[model samples]
Target: MIQAQAIRLFTNRGYDAVTVADVAEAAGVSAMTVYRHFPTKEDLVLIEQPARLIAERVAASSATQPLVLRVGGALVDAARALTGGDGDAPEASERFLLDCLRLMVSTPALRARHLDSQYALQQAIVDALGVDTTDPDAAFRAQAATSACLAVMHTALTRWAQDDGQTKLPALIERALTASFGDVATGQGD
Candidate 1:
């Protein structure tokens, strides 16, 4: 409810124009409730909850599978969980997600906070990949995988947003990852 209201407010009024109080009122709750739900304004926009879901699933994923498979599968799970129940449009949920994503990407104030949100997920990926901190090569591999996976996620999301939420986000994520990393995943790249 807080998230839905906040997105509406942010969409109706620019991110800079909205406030905790504004979202509180829209949600029919007090400022404290809004703050309690989202530690910061950017959290409302970033949908950190969903991101956390992906991180948890990814970090806890079975290591027997390929890294790309695990990351892509985790993303798919998270995206599918967004059921678009906000009563706006069929694309409302994804559109809202895309709006927040765009706002975070373009807004400098929000961008920094977005990075802070991503750090934990990145670290989770690093740990899940079992990168030995003492080994420079292992650390680089982990970093490279994290960077590439993030790129794929971003590309998929951006493309889905551009399409006005017509495509299934998870499918786009898989396609993007496959197109960009299939060779590497299949051990065919030199």
Candidate 2:
């Protein structure tokens, strides 16, 4: 509810104009309550679920599979989960995601924070991939693979937002991944 209020306020009044107190009042809660839930104003906009979900999916993947297949398949799975398995998200969720993306792209502060979020996400991916910290080669491979996958994800998401949510996100993600990594993106390589 607080996030909904924050997004609404940020959308209507602009991120700089909308204070945390304003969001709190709009949400019918105290500033303390809002702060308790979201440590900073950016937290209201930056979602943490996708990173966690992707990491979980990657961790659950079969260890026997090739690294690219395991990482790419996990990314595809996360994309599917985002769309509720129907190639499209529910109307409200879709709108929320689009709005968040729009805000992130347009707002400078949010953009900077997004970079921090991306680094955290990369760390999660590397940890989930179980890269051996002692082996520089394995660590480097995991980092590079996760970076490529994340770049694909960002491209798809930016395209989706650019289209004003007209394109289905999961399809965009899958298409972009496949185009970039070939069969490795889908675990179909022989």
Candidate 3:
């Protein structure tokens, strides 16, 4: 509820124009309640459950699976979870997600916060893989995987948004992931 209201206000009024109080009032909650739920206004827009879900999925992947497959599967699982396993997403939900993405892209402050969130998410994935962040190789692999997943997400959302909310985000995301990692995995470029 808070997230939906925040996205609406941020999109309609501009990120800089919307205050915590405004968001709370729009959501019919107290300012304190909003602050309790989200530590900052930027956080209210940037924070999401998908990253955590991806980490969990990756952690639970079979240890024997190839790293690329494990990471790609986790990303697919997270995308599927977001879409409720169906191509049909509720109109309101789709609008909210698009609005949030727009806000992140249009607002510089929000974009910075979003990047910070991504970095933290990458660290979480690194930890989940039992990779030492201090090790150059481990760090490089984690960063690469995170970047690939984010690129897939960005492409999916951009394409979906451009389609005027017609496309299924999860399928687009899955395809983007496959196109990205598939080439590298198959040695198509090299």
RMSD of each: 4.0, 1.5, 3.4
Clash pairs detected, candidate 2 = none
lDDT per residue, candidate 2, 7-85, as tens digits? 9999999999999999999999999999999999999999888888889999999777777777777777876676565
What's the true lDDT of residue 160 in model 2? 87
The most accurate candidate by lDDT is 2
lDDT of 3 by residue, 50-134 (tens): 7899889879977565566666677667766765555664555566667787888788998888878877877776666666767
Ranking by TM-score: 2, 3, 1
Our model 2 lands, by Cα RMSD against the true structure, at 1.5
Relative to the unseen true structure, what is the C-alpha lDDT of residue 67 in candidate 3, on a scale of 0 to 100?
Answer: 60
Alpha-carbon local distance difference test for all models: 0.74, 0.86, 0.75
Instruction: Give all TM-scores, in the order shown.
Output: 0.80, 0.94, 0.83
